[model samples]
Each structure stands twice: as structure tokens, then as C-alpha cells.
Target chain A: MEEVLRRQIEKIVTLTDEEFRFVLTHFTARTVKKHQYVVQAGDPAPNDHFVVKGLLKSFYTDDLGKTHILQFAMEDWWISDPQAYHNKVNATLHIDCLEDTQLFFISIDNREKLCVELQKMEYFFMKKTTAGYIALQRRILSLMSQKAEERFNQFIQLYPTLLQRVPKALIASYLGISRETLSRMSAH
Target chain B: MEEVLRRQIEKIVTLTDEEFRFVLTHFTARTVKKHQYVVQAGDPAPNDHFVVKGLLKSFYTDDLGKTHILQFAMEDWWISDPQAYHNKVNATLHIDCLEDTQLFFISIDNREKLCVELQKMEYFFMKKTTAGYIALQRRILSLMSQKAEERFNQFIQLYPTLLQRVPKALIASYLGISRETLSRMSAH
Candidate 1:
């Protein structure tokens, strides 16, 4: 599990064994069973989780009580109520395990301290955040494109792993399409 | 324009006089007339622009020839085809000036160089990117919320200045709604 994290960081910045050990000290590991909620709407969600194993999703439930999937993470990916965790606000989203999950979670304070201690981590995070921003931009483009078929195709191309792992209904929710539409699109 | 950038960066990381001067060296300032484009779909877009004055909008044009506004920036905001700028790819969106614009633009090479030479620049970019990611997440939630009225309310609260400066059709485009629907909603 630790090596999973090490490899993810190494993709951006190399770390010495001692430095890797130092980074590990800032994170705590835990396991969550399938169907467990990790972060809930209207609650304090103070940490970001890195998936070492299994699947998880974060979603928003709007005033009309309809749920919208924001994002999903599997091994080597990060998940959190980003606004809540970074801005120190109560969450407006809920995160739950889609499968039995093993993960490492880090608080924003510890992440900041680690960055100050290790500038390389800061660069890694900057690179990661920029990449994440680009991805969200892409998603916005797809949503605004208003072609459900184009969106489904783009999703599969970007996250082929997700297509195999996440349920069709959840994928529809994330794509902002109805399940019937997704079912028809998948058939094609 | 230089001071506009200085204040923007200083909001996150304070810099000395010499340091700020070094930062300015990497950027090139320019003035663009209204309706001019800084980036166009299918072209290579190499820089990110910080708006020192005026307004701009970045939008995606679909295959069916409809345009959807992805974002708008006024004075003190930044605009770019982020994926093209960061990933060195051809653009998939067009960014054009909504008003005669004065701006400072920086290439990715200079940006990376600035980060390497002055580590503070890296932190500044990271903080900006993370905040950007959070804002995009919020937008995604709004888009997926499936309530046009809620989306309009959220947009006004977040970018009240835009309502006065931008055309209603563009605002409707940004919110992924029809112009007639926006006119009706705004009347309330």
C-alpha cells in the first residue's frame, strides 16, 4: 500500500527512501468496508484520501434530493470533499466506498507542513493540481457540449478502468445523463 | 499590469522588490481589442493571460455549431486553454476578449523556469491551481444539479460583476441554458 503511494509521487518527483519515510509519517492508513460513508454532506471533512486498494466515490445531493456523482477514485487516485477540506468548510458532498477499501488519509495541516519540509512534495502537488484542473476543464467541455454520446465516449477514453469498475447508473449520474440514455448509449 | 500581477501573487506568497522584478521578466504585456482571440480551437495555445483590464470568455464550440461558455474573466482574473498551455497540446477551446483588454501573458516554459528559479512561483501556481480545481468542482456540481434557477442564483452570487458587464446570452450559455429561460429567470 505504501509503495502504491510512493509510485504515484515518483511519477512526478523522485524521493529518497528516507524522504519517503518522512512523507509516510504525515499520512495514516485505514480500511473501509463496502457501503461505508467516509464523508457526509453538512459535516466536517478534514482530510483527503489516497486510494491504495478498491474503489470510492464522492457525490453531491442537491436540494431536490437527487444525487450527482462528482468523481470516483480507485488505486493510486485521490478523493476528498476538496472545497470542504481545503477551504475549512463543512462538506456539501458525501464520499463512500464502492468496494472494500484500503487508503491513506492526510489532513490539510499535515500536507502543508510536509510541503514546507519537502519542497519536492509541493511541486508534485502543484503538478497534480494543474493536471486535475485540466481534467475538470475537459469535463466541463463535455457537459456543455450537450451530446450524451460524445460525453460517454470521452469518459471511456479517459478512464477505461472506470468503465469496467463503476456501475452504469453512477456513470450516467456523473455524465449528467439518465440511466436509460446511458443504457442505450452503451448498447451502441 | 506588473503591479496587478504582483498583488495577485502577493495574496498567496509575499515577494521582495527584487523578487517581484525577476517575476515580471518572464511575462510579456499586450493590449487586445474587443473580439480578438488569444486562443482558438485546433491551434496551439502556449500562454496563460492575467487580465490587467477588461473582460474575456473561453468557450467550446460543439460539432453542431453551438457554443458553450466555459468561463469568463475580468480584471485580476486569469484565462487560457489550460490543457493546451500545460500539456503542450493544440487547443480544444477558443478564448476571446469580450472588451478591449490589457493583459500579461506567460508561456509554460517561462512558468516552469520561474518556478525552478524562484520556488515561491511554484507555490503560487499550486495554490492558484488548487483553488481553480475547487471552483471547477463547484461548477460541476451546479451543472449536475439539474435546476436552471439554482444555477443562475449561484452564478450571480459568485460573479455579480459579470451580470452587469456581460451580455445575457453569454451568461445563459455559461449556465448551459437557453436565452429565453435566462431572460425569464433574471426578470424575477
Candidate 2:
């Protein structure tokens, strides 16, 4: 588990062995069953879960009761509602395990304390957030510019492995398209 | 100017007088004329500009010639095209000065070099980028959930001083509304 996470962190910032060990001690491992909700909308977000194994998705239900998937986290990814997690407010989204999952949970309090000790860890998070923001901005622009089929093709291209793992219906919802539309498009 | 910047830096991470001076040497002060483009679409972005005075905007023009205003920066704010600035790629967005402006420019290369000297400076930037990402996520959610009037009102509430300084057309574009609609709403 430390090996996988260490590799992920190395991509963002290099840490000394001592610093990595200090950072690792704070995270608590938690196992979640498939389809289990780790967090739900309106509940307080306790931690930013780092995926060690399996898959998770964070989503929100709109006024019409339509589930809009905001993010999908596979191995080595971090999943949380950033605003809710930072502020410790009632979450406006839900995170659920799509497969039986192993995760490292780091709470906001722990994150703040960790940043105090290991400043380089902050760099790891900042790089992740910046990368996420850039991707989101491009995703929004694509949603505005591209057709549904084109968006789906792009999504498949970007996360080909995850595409086979997640259901098409959920993927369609995430893409802001009807499941029927997704089926029709996939058939072509 | 240094005093104000010091306070801003302290909001993220504390810097000693000597450390702050070290950072100051790396930044070049620039003055932008009104209506001048600081970073244009298709040009590689050179630096992240920190506003000392005046206003600037970053926007994207789509194939249909509709401009999507992504962000507006005022005094004490940092502005850049994230993808272009971070990846050193040709920008898909343009940044223009709304008024005659004074700014401190820091190249990405210089910033990385400085981080080796002052790790705390890196922590400062990390927090700033995280805050920016969180704010941008909220803005995107507002675009998804709120009506034009609500977004306009929220924009006004957040940047009352900027509302007075920037033109109606840019504000309309920022709110994703027609200029006529913004005029009507403002009149009412």
C-alpha cells in the first residue's frame, strides 16, 4: 500500500524516506464493500480518501433526482468534495465504492497538522488540485463544444481501463447524457 | 508594494524579512496599458502575474466567436492561464488588462528555482493554488446550478469594487449572459 502511494506522491514531489514515513503514519486504512457509500450528500465529509485498490465515484443528485457523477477515483487517486472537505461542512455530494475498496483516509485536521510537519506534502496536494482544476476547465469547455458521442469517445480514450470497470449507465449520467443515448451511441 | 505582498504571503505561509527579500528579487514589475493583452490565445504564456493595481480578465473565444470569461483579477490577486502557464503550451485563452495596471511577474522556471532556495515559498504557492482551485470549482457549480441573476448578484457581492471598475460587456460574458440581458438586469 505504501509502495503504491509512494509512487503516486513521487510523480508530484520527491520526499525523503523519513518524511514519507512520517506522512504515512497519519493515514488510517479502511476497507469498503462494493456499492457502499463512504460519504453521502448532506453528511459531513470526514476525510479525503486515497484509493489503494478498487474504484470509487463522487456524485451529486440534482433537483430532478438525477445523479450526476462529478468524479471517479481508481487506484492511487484521491477522492473528496474539495470545498466540503476543506470547510468541514455538510457534503453536497456522495462518494461510493464501485468495487470492494481499500483506501487511506486522511481527515482535514490530520492534513493541517501534516502540512505543519512535512511541507513538501503540501506540494503533492497542490499539484493534484491544480491538475484536477485544469482537467475540469477543459472538460467544461468540451461539454460546451462537443457532441455527446464525441465526449464519450474522449472519456473512453482518457480512461479506457476504468471504462470497462464502470457501468455504461453511470458513465452516461456522468457525461450528462441519458442512458438510452449512451446505448445508441455505443452501438454505432 | 512589498508590504502588501508580504501580508498576502503571510496569509498562506510566513516568510522572514530576508526570505521575502529573496523572493522580491526574482519578480519583475510590469505596467500594462489599458486595453492591452497581457497573454493572448495561441501564444505560450510566460509568467503568472500578481496584480499590484488595476484589473485584468482571462477569457476564451469559441468557434462561434462567443467569449467565455473564465476569471477576473484585481489588486492583490494572481492571474494566469493555468494550462498554458503550467504546461508551457500555447494558450487557448486570452488575458487582457481592463485598466492601466501594475503587476509582479514570476516565470515558472524562476519559481521552481526559488522553491529549492525557499521551500516555504513553495508552500505559499501551494495554498494559493488550492484556494484558487476550490474557488473555481464553486464558480463552475454556480454556473451549473444558479440562474444568471443570482450569479450576477453573487459576482457583485464578492467584487463590489471590481463591478464598478469593469465594463458591462465583460461582466455579461463572465456571467454567461447577453449584454442586453445584463443591461436589463442592472437597470432593474
Candidate 3:
């Protein structure tokens, strides 16, 4: 599990074993069963979780009780109520394990302290955050401009493995499309 | 204009006079007239612009010729095609001035070099990018779940100055509301 995190960091900036050990000290690990909530709406969000194994999702539940999928995290992906974590506010979204999950989590203060201690870690985080920013922008564009079919195709192309992992209804919710529309598109 | 840029950076990380001057050396200043594009689809996005004065918008045009406004940037804000600028791809969005605009722009290479030379700048950028990621997430939730009236009200509350500065049609497009719906909401 630690090796998975080491490799993810190494992809951006190489770290010495000593440096990696230092980085490891700032994080704590947890295991969660399927359907366990890691974050719940209206609760303070202090940590950002980096998936060591298994699947999880973060979603927003509207006042009408409609669940809108915000994101899915698999191996090596990070998940958090970013606004809540960064701003020290209550979460507006909830994150739950879709499969039995293992995660390494770091609080915002510890993450900042690590960045200040290690310039390489700061660089790694900046690159990761920038990439995340780009991905979110693309999702926004897809939601605003793409039709249902186009969005489904784009999603499939972008995450071929997710189709098998995530339920079709959840994917439809993520795409802001009806499950029937996703079924028709997937059939094609 | 330089002071505005300095103030924005200082909000995240403090910089000495000499360091700020060194930072300014990496950027090139430009003035653009209203309706002039800083970026256009199909062109390589090499620079991210920091608005020193005036307003601009970034939008995508779908295949059917429908335009969707992605964001509006005013003084003290940064705007770019994040995917294109970060990934070094051709622009998919067009950013044009809504008023006579002055900007200081930095290319990816120069920005990376600055980060390497000054860890403070890297930290500053990481904070900015994270805030951007949070704002984009909020926008996604609004698009997925909010009614047009709610979205418009959120927009007005978040950016009161923009309602007066940007044209009504663009604001409607940004809110994903019809112009008539916006009119009705505004009248109320």
C-alpha cells in the first residue's frame, strides 16, 4: 500500500528513501468496508484520502434527495471534499467506499508542513493539483457542452476500466444523463 | 498593475521587492482591445494570463455552433485554457476581452523555472490552483443540481461586480439559463 503511494509520488518527483520515510510520517492509514462513509455532508473535512486499494466515490446529494456523482477514485487516485478540506468548512459532499478500501490520509496542515519541509513534495503537489484542476475543467465543459452520447463516449474513452467497475446508473448520474440514455449509448 | 500582481501573489506567499522584480521579468505585458482574443481554438496555448485590468471570458463552441461560457476573469484574476496550457495542447476554448484589457502572461517553461528557483512561488501557485479546483467543483455541483434561479442568485452573490460589467447574454450563458429566464430572475 505504501509502495503504491511511493510510486505515485515518484511519477512526478523522485524521492530518496529517507525523504519518502519523512513523507510517510505525516500520513495515517485506514481500512474501510464497502458502503462505509469516509466523509459525510455537513461534517468537518480535515483529511484528503489517497486510495491505496479498492474503489470509492464522492457525491453531492441535493435538497430533493437526488444524488449527483462528483467523482470516483480507484487505485492511486485521491479523494476529498476539497473545498471543505482547504477552507476548514463543513463538507457539502459525501465520500463512501464502493469496495472494501484501504487509504492513506493527510490533514491540510500536515500536507502544508510537508510541502514547506520538502520542496520536491511541494512541486509534486503543485503538478498533481494542476492536473486535477485541468480534469475538473474538462468535466465542466463536457457537462455544459456535450450531448449525452458524446459525454458517454468521452467517459468510456477516458476511463475504459471504470465502465466495468462503476454501476451504469452511477455513471449516468455522473454524466447528468438518464440511465435509459446511458443504456442506449452503451449499446451502440 | 505590477502592484496588483504583487498583491495577488503576496496573498498566498510573501515576496521581497527583488524577488517580485525577478518574477516580473518572466512575464510579458500586453494590452488587448474589447472583442480581441487572447486565445482561440486550434492554437497552441503557451501562456496563462493574469488580468491586471479589465474583464475577459473563456468559452467553448460546440459542434452545433452553440457557445457555452466557462468562466469570466476580471482584475486580479487568472484565466487560461487549463487543459491546453498545462498539457501543452491546442486550445479548445476562446478567451476574449470584454473590456480593454491589460495582462501579464507567463509561459509554462518560465513558470516552471520560477517555481524551481523560488519555492514560495511554487507554493503560491499550488494554493491558487487548489482554490481553482474548489471553485470548479462548486460550478459542477451548481450545473448538476441547482435550478436556474438558484444558479443565477449564487452567481450574483459571488460576483456582484460582474453582473454590472458583463453583458446579460453572456451572464445567462454562464449560468446555463435562457436570457428570458435571467431577465425574469433579475426583475424579481
Highest-TM-score candidate: 3
The number of the candidate with the highest DockQ is 3
Model 1 spans with C-alpha error above 4 angstroms: none
lDDT of 2 by residue, B64-174 (tens): 886778889999999998898888898898999989999998998898788768878877787687777778766666655567898889998988997788899989877
Tell me each candidate's TM-score: 0.97, 0.89, 0.97
Docking class of 1: high
lDDT of 1 by residue, B1-188 (tens): 68889999999999999999999999999999999999999999999999999999999888889888999999989999999999999999999999999999999999999998998888898888888999998888878886898899988998899999999999999999999999999998
The TM-scores of chain A alone, one per candidate, are 0.98, 0.96, 0.98
CA RMSD per model (angstroms) = 1.3, 2.5, 1.2
Residue-level lDDT tens digits of model 3 in B1-188: 78989999999889889999999999999999999999999999899999999999999999999999999999999999988898999999999999999999999989999988988888888889999999999999999999999999999899999999999999999988899999988997
CAPRI band of model 3?
Answer: high
Cα-based lDDT at residue B134, candidate 1: 94
Put down candidate 3 lDDT per residue, A1-188, tens digits, no spaces.
Answer: 89999999999999999999999999999999999999999999999999999999999999999999999999999999999999999999999999999999999999989988998988888888998998998898888888899999999999998999999999999999999999988887
For candidate 3, the lDDT comes to: 0.94
Best by lDDT: 3
